[model samples]
Target: MVGVPVVLGVRRSAPVPVPGAPDAGAALVDGYGRVHRDLRISLTDRCSLRCTYCMPEQGNEWLARSSILTTDEIVRVAEVAAAAGITTFRLTGGEPLLRADIADVVSRLARITGPGGPVQVAMTTNGIRLPDLLPGLIAAGLARLNISIDTLDRDRFHRLTRRDRLDEVRAGIAAAAASGLRPLKLNAVAMRGINDDELCDLVDYAVTHDAELRFIEQMPLDAGHTWDRDAMVTREEILATLAGRWDLTPVPGRHGAPAERFLLDGGPATVGVIASVTAPFCGDCDRLRLTADGQLRNCLFSTSEYDLLPTLRGTDSRTVDAVLRACVRGKLPGHAINDPSFLQPARGMNAIGG
Candidate 1:
């Protein structure tokens, strides 16, 4: 998704102590008492498919190869984050699997340890390349996978992504499941007049394939800035559509998870909705984003980003830790979608590390 600027708000809750590190317990704790534990690292800003919602079809600017963080730099920053109570490292990208040494990156990150234990590594990908990359990623200690498969129809998929690799994505999904990537998630962007009609079919596909399905509310992250609120398929509409077809019971105890899960009444099938637009979850969010160029974002919608590449290259680990702590201290309470003054962020989703 694209970055959205958050409106500042007064602190409302008592400061929550970090679990293990008492001395530097506040490293990942923001002003509002939200403790960040998950970090999303964007591996690259280049993707094979020019998805209409994520990037412009033509004249898209690609990041310079020299500007992107190297595998060593990524691991160094992740190590500092791990020590500061961040345990989960989710590798994202314009398309992460696009990186030639992505498995090396995963292996290096998997070696990092925090107060909890060894850090858990996961990835979010377009899945067109998963069939070839899945085995290596799993072998390198990747714990989970979130594959974006927006539509089941081949023609519709091509229409949205401008790519005709839906068959490859399907095979990739099967390979991931067969390889035992537990909690494999399929992310779908719910857009009106497009794939909204396939909600049930998508859920059925997930159930049949033994994967979890999640429908994300389309945000104003398109490269062309053509997103309209009226054109979005809201969370309410998604739930109503599913409720009419299946018996769904809310699955509780989802503290920092972005998706609100539901259990399909008749079987082991379950589906989730990431209601980022209609029902914002910023208050319970515990994520920090690292762009491909080494900028750290406290929130997905944060306008401000702290540059970590210089410190990673020049300074010691202590300085990197300090930079991380300072970034967390300044995190906003929420991404101000409800505020009248809200503005779309300058960077699109591909640049922001969705």
Candidate 2:
């Protein structure tokens, strides 16, 4: 509630009609000159666990099944993106595992080709069902994985997620490692009084499981709109906590990666911190998000969304591509979380892609 609250309604921005669509082979470049190649697609807005930092415990309306893009429609969008310049596709969601046909979706997206080559397909999941679904996903061409785990204590996990599924999550993490997935990552949102103390422990757990851990500074994307910046932990504090145990050496040339990686004690084992609040990386952002309901989001904190469901259902691929270009062209220079005039989006992280 830091910014002025806007009345909640349909925040979708009507797709603008352009004189003509940009070249089909043109890259997805915003006005700021950043060529976007990474696309985060939200398969569904429904999740298994109600994480306190993501959504509320109850009374939240879910996206209608009919409103969500079907498998065919999703493939159509990916095809358009692939034809353009998008080379990386990261499937996100309230919980992407909730999608019954997730393997099918991955198999189809893996076949897409971008300017680089065959587009890389990855996913960020809660990892509750990974134990049962990792094999199918791997066979379907999931190149990488990122699992969310904020705490190691079972009671703390239950309190944060409002679900008793830490064992299942751990099992899922194990399953990912067993599958021989390279660079398996664990994402933990750093909260001051919540999981801040467990920074080293989480890194240790990641090192033990042969997975890299990233500490993400909690942003203002909760469904309840009650995010307090003062309560959120910063990147300096996270590094300080870990530096108390090991010497964290900075890894240079991160490029467009969200996490600023550091070598723990100058070894193969490493840790990362995504300081979205204190240290914004919007200047080099090369990513775009498409919601399950077929809206293209330029930024994570975007107040406006470009509706693509109508274009997908009514027009040809060129028209859809035009909408996509327009969406990127409308991107703001940065997410002004530090600016007093900034306003939180009407939709939360679950509604947006994570």
Candidate 3:
């Protein structure tokens, strides 16, 4: 994870190709005609953690520095996405902090100039290196942070991820809060036998730290493909487990964070459930993923992709806009996280920048 300096911060209003003028395609137009507001850009395909739900079971070779996107190239892609009406720029990766010049990249994105559009920039990381990086990120215009912490048990953490940076992740959370990461979010995947008993404990921890803790379903993304109904700790069960211990007040959302949030005790700390399996909210979904390897994935379930790097490096602004628009038009309404007919892909979450 210590491979590159990250370029953080993205400007949403930078001049970019207009919609369908010449090269602008259907990317600006969604199924419901709402312009794309959020863009997820993967910075690198390298990661240090080998979480069971993410990386390969045996582990794979990490990407070299040369193969990852450059600062200018990443900004160009963000500019095109902003031109396509994307307002939220999330720097994601196999691990975003691994990319060199990430801070520079973030700064460049923040200065992009487009009329009447101000973008919010953020990053999602494994939190292995946030302690030393949060200050630089905030100084460069990072708006918020999302730290992925799956469980609290140290041994289970070791079993799930081959590393033992749990303490580092905690330190990162504290450092991020002190460094202006307001309302930090902690994304957790609740495994059936792994950490399901810690549901109430997780809520308590969230309340204690004033963090938004979200319990996500165990996805069928890893190459193992061993997910079953037994492995899935449904949303209803999660809610019941938490509610039985503490009173919950359902929290309403605006754009829908893909998680149904609820205040644990009518306070700032909230507990959310991302029930992609028990209850899929694909209809109101609005998300797109760009892999670190330059592939544009419309849906996490589909292995298919629309390559954007070729056009990104050679084409004019119009051509880039057209390709992005085409990819957006091709966005699926929702993903079948529960349908039995949908055989999930073999790639793990890390492969696609979860």
Model 3, 39-78: lDDT tens per residue? Answer: 7888876776888777764648665555566777778787
Residue 28 alpha-carbon offset, candidate 2, angstroms: 1.1
**Any idea how many clashes model 1 has?**
1
Report the alpha-carbon TM-score of model 1 versus the true structure: 0.92
Q: After aligning candidate 2 to the native by TM-score, how far in Å is the CA of 157 from where it should be? A: 0.7
Candidate 2 lands at a TM-score of 0.93
Q: Order of all candidates by TM-score, from best down to worst?
A: 2, 1, 3
lDDT tens readout by residue for model 1, 1-354 = 965345444122323434333245444777666878999999998888888988987898888888899998898889888988999999998999999999999999998989889999999998888888788888899999999999999999899989899998899888887887798899999989999899999998988878989999999887788989899999999999999889999898988899999999855789999988778877788999999998889977777899887787875454778778778877766778657777777788999988
- Looking at model 3, residue 199 earns an lDDT score of 81
Each model's C-alpha lDDT? 0.85, 0.88, 0.72
The segments of candidate 3 whose C-alpha lies over 4 angstroms from its true place after superposition are 1-27, 32-34, 61-66, 113-115, 315-318
C-alpha lDDT of residue 185 in model 2: 97
lDDT of 2 by residue, 1-354 (tens): 444322222122312323343566788877666778899999999999999988999998999988999999999999999888999999999899999999999999999887678999999999999989999999999999999999999999999999999999999999998889998999999988888889999999999989999999999999888999899898889988999999999999987789999999997999999988888877778899999999999989999999999898885454888889989878777787887777888998998997
Model 1 scores what on Cα lDDT?
0.85
Single out the weakest 10-residue window by summed lDDT for candidate 2.
5-14
